[model samples]
Target: MKIRILTRIALLAAASAASFAHAAPAMVTEGILTGGNGMTLYTFDRDAAGSGKSACNDACAKNWPPLKARDDDIAGGDYSIVMRDDGSKQWAYKGKPLYFWVKDQQPGDKTGDGVNNAWHVVKP
Candidate 1:
């Protein structure tokens, strides 16, 4: 019975580990931004900071999800929150909206940068 319980505990631990393996990101490195899962973060050229809005919507947004801002998040310095067309709040750096590319699978992947001459990595 003890061995059975031990095996169950081991299996549960392994499952937890697998689940948390990709539960990272939402982190910023130096001046560069990262996604909730460690993928590269980017911004769209069409997005206008002066307008305080995100232009990437509909099909574009499906591939690039905005970095969400929590209700308790407070804007400080270069970081701020902007309202999207869908009424969702997103994190912004220097007024530019932040997004995650669907194709970026790894932590440092920059595959989405310069795509179609619009997407670019968010720099410091």
Candidate 2:
């Protein structure tokens, strides 16, 4: 009976680790891209897609916080990583870097859309 219990515990631990590895930092929420916390994600028009870099930095990054990614985080599907001006990693989708508006106080808020005709929420 003890051996059976030990085997079951090992299986559960392996499954949990696998789930974390494949988990995406962002997901489609209400038909739009949102962080794991459900906050809306946006893209800047000034950021050239597929550049592997983010144009929003310094003061610009203050208002629109980049979707940060850790060194261990893996990118898959339409998700990718872009190096920031500070040499940090950020999450991107389809080559466009993702960000969050500071004014958004709660999840599902898209107050950052169309800001200065540049910022827009990522769809799908």
Candidate 3:
């Protein structure tokens, strides 16, 4: 009976770990740009480059919050991590950083697009 109980506990622990491994990474998106959950979509400016670093910070980051990446978020294809000055990980696509709009209240809102002559939707 003790052996059976130990086996059941081990199985449960393994199942829990497996579920966490399969979880999707969180991303930001523009409602007008992609059809998926707009919260998981991200965008970059046309002029931004994968080699160059980001310039948005401080108050800028308050209005356009960076789509942060968790430690388990594995990058694929054009997706990468940008190290912020605040020592946080920000998700980047094709080398351009991703951001969410403070004014965007709902999932389908596109209030951030075309703002300040910059900002574009991030595609997967």
Best by TM-score: 2
Q: State each candidate's clash count.
A: 0, 0, 7
- Expressed as tens digits, the lDDT of each residue in 20-113 for candidate 2 is 7757979898899999889999999999999999999999999999999999887778999999999999999999999999999999899999
Write down the TM-score of every candidate.
0.73, 0.83, 0.65
Which one wins on lDDT? 2
Model 3: weakest 10-residue lDDT segment is 27-36
Residues 1-124, candidate 3, lDDT per residue (tens digit)? Answer: 9999999999999877765663334443432333224543446464266754556778988988887777666666666777777878877767777777888887767677778768765545
Q: Per-residue lDDT for 52 in model 2?
A: 97
lDDT ranking of the models: 2, 1, 3
Candidate 3: which pairs clash?
Answer: 28-41, 28-42, 29-41, 42-122, 43-121, 43-122, 50-95
lDDT of 1 by residue, 1-124 (tens): 9999999999999877765554222567656787666677898988887568899888988999888876655666677789888888888878888999988877888999999999999776
Once fitted onto the true fold, the runs of candidate 1 whose alpha carbons sit more than 4 angstroms away are 1-31
For model 3 the local lDDT of residue 61 reads 86
Query: lDDT (0-100) at residue 59 of candidate 2?
Result: 99
Which 10-residue window of candidate 2 scores lowest in summed lDDT? 14-23
Q: What lDDT does each candidate get? A: 0.80, 0.94, 0.65
